[model samples]
Target: MVGALIIALGILSAGWLLLKALSRGQTADFTAIRLALARYLALALEFQLGADILSTAISPTWEQLGKLGAIAIIRTALNYFLSREMRDERGQTSAEKPVVERAD
Candidate 1:
């Protein structure tokens, strides 16, 4: 539950960063990063919610461990995706333009 909230906060922070990027005219790259972050955040929320449902439905069984495995896998994937999104955000840098060649 706490992890899910952290992921949500990350998504919100990424959104704010993306807004800053867009205001600086970095629409193309920022869009990609923003989408990635949003995706991971949503996935993390879904994973937690589903795990809660699973536990509610099943007290204990061999399937409990299997559900736990699924939860871990989903969380891992979300973490990887979030990492990639952060990298993408950092990559959206404003490149310094080369000075115009001085004509003779």
Candidate 2:
């Protein structure tokens, strides 16, 4: 129940942020928005994985174990890609910024 709530909250928050960004019209930085959504989704996935683990702990059936394993693998892959994308985005943003040289 808690996990579902967390996931819902994450989705709602991401949608709100996206809508807010869209309302900004031409001045909105989409890269930043994407980063924010990715972060929220990653967090939500973590909570979901935790919930699955808890469920498996309570009942150790073969079917349940297989389901958990598949879920874990999928979530882990998603998380890994999300994190990599976030890192790349951060690096790209930083690189795009103009660095001012200090005058002696």
Candidate 3:
């Protein structure tokens, strides 16, 4: 309960900071905040999934764990890739980032 609350608060605060920075035309700062928020969101997912693994009445424990690990890895990578795309959209990257947003 407490962990979830903390994660929620962190997400909100980071998102607020990102929006505020973007509104100020600080693209660099906004990108930084956006990355930070992504990290926090990943952590929250990891924590929640971990708790679910332990507490939830799920079947096939080992298989579930393996799938969870894969999911976490994929999700984290997706977030990073999306961040790169966003930065590219903002003209931060040297190469042109993909215009379409698709999960890897």
Best by lDDT: 2
Clashing pairs in 3: none
lDDT of 1: 0.67
Query: Using TM-score as the measure, which candidate wins?
Result: 2
Q: Estimate, for each residue in 1-104, the C-alpha lDDT of model 3 and write its tens digit.
A: 64477568778888788778778888754555655665566566666666655653456577776876776677667657766665664566434446777899
Worst 10 residues of 2 by lDDT: 21-30
**Reference-based TM-score, model 2:** 0.79
lDDT of 3 at 72: 61
Cα lDDT of model 1 by residue, 1-104, tens digit: 75477577777878788788878987755555566566667666666757666675667666777777776687667667766765665555433334588889
Decoy 3 TM-score against native:
0.44
Residue 52 lDDT, candidate 3, scale 0-100: 59
Give TM-scores for every candidate, taking all chains together and pairing residue i with residue i. 0.45, 0.79, 0.44
Clash statistics: count for each candidate: 0, 0, 0
2 or 3, which is superior by lDDT?
2
Our model 1 lands, by Cα RMSD against the true structure, at: 7.0
* TM-score: the better of candidates 1 and 3: 1
Candidate 1: misplaced stretches above 4 Å? 31-60, 77-104
Per-candidate local distance difference test = 0.67, 0.84, 0.65
* Candidate 2 RMSD computed on C-alpha atoms after optimal superposition onto the true structure: 2.4
